[model samples]
Target: MTVCEMCGKETEVFSAIIEGSELTVCAACGRFGKMLRKPVMRVVKKQAVEKAPGPVETVVTGFASLIRSAREKAGLTQKDFAMSLNEKESIVQKLENGAFVPPISLAKKLEKLLKIKLVEFEQEDEVSNEKRGSGPLTIGDILNVKK
Candidate 1:
């Protein structure tokens, strides 16, 4: 007969074996042994929360507004636009609402679908006005010499 160190019980046979050691335990002690055994798990779940917004939010805002305006002008709802792009409606909504940054591929697809350029540039009218005010000059003007 052997004794269980945990419950101070003696038994005819060892009820639990751990790390090359046998435990002689009564029925009540055996229940305690089962409790001590570790459970086998392949994966453990972890919870994640969304990160807080930062400086990039401003840039995303401009992109989101551009996408929203283009979609609206094209007469498509968020669901309709997302379906056309083979993407989730939530993704379109998030982009429209400035909740997420869109990948370049998505932006290019949007530009093609909407037929509107989304690139950032100086206002066309402002640029044209500047060009108009600048009088025509010859090659001599560029060389800083009068013909």
Candidate 2:
């Protein structure tokens, strides 16, 4: 069943031009506009596409302590380590304090420099039987307008 675009009534719809804009409205609302064609009833079909689980790289838990311990073991102060990494000292401090999460590139650099395992790969959650198709949404469907 198709719904009228203007009045939101579930009935047959006709393609029409109302106030210079096209709308799929019912027969009652169609009188407010110039009818373009015959009434149209749309049939929506949904198909589920299976998605394979993919590998996603993520930082290990307790990364801040791991990085701090590794850096301390390497006998490098935060400032010196930041200088060696070409990053701000504040960023290094934030990383050690668990306030910042490093991107993949930075994590790789840290792993190489500190000789610590920072990134781990895990399989992403697979999505099964997801619905795909629905009718076009009207403005009323999107926004809660007060009368």
Candidate 3:
């Protein structure tokens, strides 16, 4: 079985052109696009494997100290650094004091200016649902249960 590119649902899908992009989507999502081909049903499998989660970019620990030290070594005051970044001095002060966690965009800017590593990519482990089994059946599944 294929996964829908739009909804991330595992089911039969069809190739479609959506908003100038070609994507494989399920029936419900296919409505928004021009279907290039009809969905072909396949034998259902007892087990379905989900794709592993992608790596996430997160600000590193001790970011406040790193930024402060870098800025000091560069001989730039808080106001000067803020002006260079086109940001307010209060924002820079908060970042240096550990009172604020910079977003990805801000972190990237700091890394470029300070030449320090502030962002790290973390890989999340895949969770196996087989051991836990499926949770309580939904109303739709219960209604579809065979006698």
Candidate 4:
């Protein structure tokens, strides 16, 4: 049986919906996509639960540090990197100082512009924490939108 890349559910080959140019998601995640696309007012309760106490300050600090390290490794100053993202230098400075949280679209743009992989730390930790019987983790797992 083939597995749905988005939700990790098993499915037969013909039972998936193509989304964009990349994803072939199962029916549930396809419905999820539809829900996401709909206007906010029309939606009922969502399945995902928001975790209390958003990411710790340390995690934000670490993300900023990773951005700085990647930029430095690429031999680009904050100004140059910001210019590449069509963003302001001050914004880049703020991000490096953990004073801002970038949107996922911006994060993807930065990853492409800087040629760096910035993954979600909690997911990484969970994968490492599993001692046995855990299947190989995919990029989708690391980037899943956890509310």
Q: Which stretches in model 2 have alpha-carbon errors above 4 Å?
A: 1-52, 130-147
Model 2 CA lDDT for position 21: 98
Give the number of the best model, judged by TM-score: 3
- Once fitted onto the true fold, the runs of candidate 4 whose alpha carbons sit more than 4 angstroms away are 1-61, 119-147
Quote the lDDT for 64 in model 1: 82
lDDT for each residue of candidate 2 in 1-147, tens digit (9 for 90 to 100): 688899999987889999999999989999998999876445798988855669989998899999999999999999999999989999999999999999988999999999999999978764323332365544544353448
lDDT of 1 at 95: 86
Better of 1 and 4 by TM-score: 4
Q: What is the lDDT for 37 in model 3?
A: 93
lDDT of 4 by residue, 1-147 (tens): 556678788763223334543454566776644322321223477698745534422223366888888889999998888888899999899888878877766777777876766544342234333443467756755563647
Q: Following a full C-alpha superposition, what root-mean-square deviation does model 1 have from the true structure?
A: 21.2
Error of 3 at 92 (Å): 0.5
Error of model 1, residue 110, in angstroms: 0.8
lDDT of each: 0.64, 0.87, 0.89, 0.64
**Top candidate, metric lDDT:** 3
The global Cα lDDT (0 to 1) of model 1 is 0.64
In terms of lDDT, model 4 sits at: 0.64
**Cα lDDT, model 3, residue 145:** 35
